[model samples]
Target: MGSGIPVWSDLTISDGLKYISGSYKIAMVYSGDSAPMLVLENKHSYSWDICISASEVSSGVAFYSYDDIAQAFSNYGVS
Candidate 1:
């Protein structure tokens, strides 16, 4: 797969929040000793990919849309 982020046009933030809040299937990809990367797949045709630092893995942060992720980054002055 390409390293570029995936685009999800059909999913909304509310939908993502509900999926995370409810039971969902997740796939974990680990690289060396670093924290495992997490992914939540949409049964249809997309997935939400998250890469958390080792320290923040235990502190759950739910993201429901691209806007949500963008807002979070903006909060940290990542724009």
Candidate 2:
């Protein structure tokens, strides 16, 4: 697998925000006062011949809100 940043398509950011928001809300239903942590992953490489899954790297941030997700994306240059 190659090691580098993944470039997101134009709609990815907006769509990702919606996904995170929805996920958080769903988790809130069961979380009580605890926060739901989202793991941010980026796929850096993939090959059909590898006979395995794509390569991904975690952002190492425990995102708990839309602002945290947005800031992490910006910090990692995901756009």
Candidate 3:
């Protein structure tokens, strides 16, 4: 994984979501499973106004945390 972050490649999206929706901080999202859309955890309060967009071809793992999402947007000056 990039930046030396360990990615659980063995875990499927459903399995990853189970842990992510609970306490797990990160997961690897395969290119095939990712789409051009925002995925927010409804259980947590988030800034609905923030819009971060990326291409479908930018394949990589992503974090589900609000802080991570916000940082990603900030990186692109979208926040």
Candidate 4:
């Protein structure tokens, strides 16, 4: 992560959603699964590839939380 980049893990859900809506990619991954079921891109550029892991929280269906997704972007320098 770059020093100038905003820390995604610190953003609130409301703020995170607003930011990603402008330009970002979203993928829904099942809990414990290794693949994303749906990939959503909103004016986002695929300048680089990113992989996000499952939340690992036991649930009937697992999905990446907003903060988790944001952190992945931050970790990979998506911005």
Whole-model lDDT values for every prediction: 0.37, 0.36, 0.43, 0.45
lDDT of 4: 0.45
- Residue pairs clashing, model 2: none
What is the overall TM-score of model 4 with all chains considered together? 0.38
Off by over 4 Å in 4: 1-44, 57-60
What digit string (tens of lDDT, one per residue) describes model 1 on residues 23-67? 333322333444443333435654433333322332343223344
> For all candidates, what are the clash counts?
0, 0, 0, 1
What C-alpha lDDT, on a 0 to 100 scale, does residue 65 get in candidate 2? 48
Model 3, stretches more than 4 Å misplaced?
1-63
TM per model? 0.25, 0.33, 0.24, 0.38
Query: What is the alpha-carbon lDDT for the whole of candidate 3?
Result: 0.43
Task: Give me the displacement of residue 51 in model 4, in angstroms.
Answer: 1.5
lDDT per residue for candidate 2 within 1-79, as digits (tens), equals: 2123333322123344455552452111112333323344543442111111112223432224455555556666654
lDDT top scorer: 4
What is the descending lDDT order?
4, 3, 1, 2
Candidate 2 residue spans exceeding 4 A from truth: 1-18, 21-37, 44-63
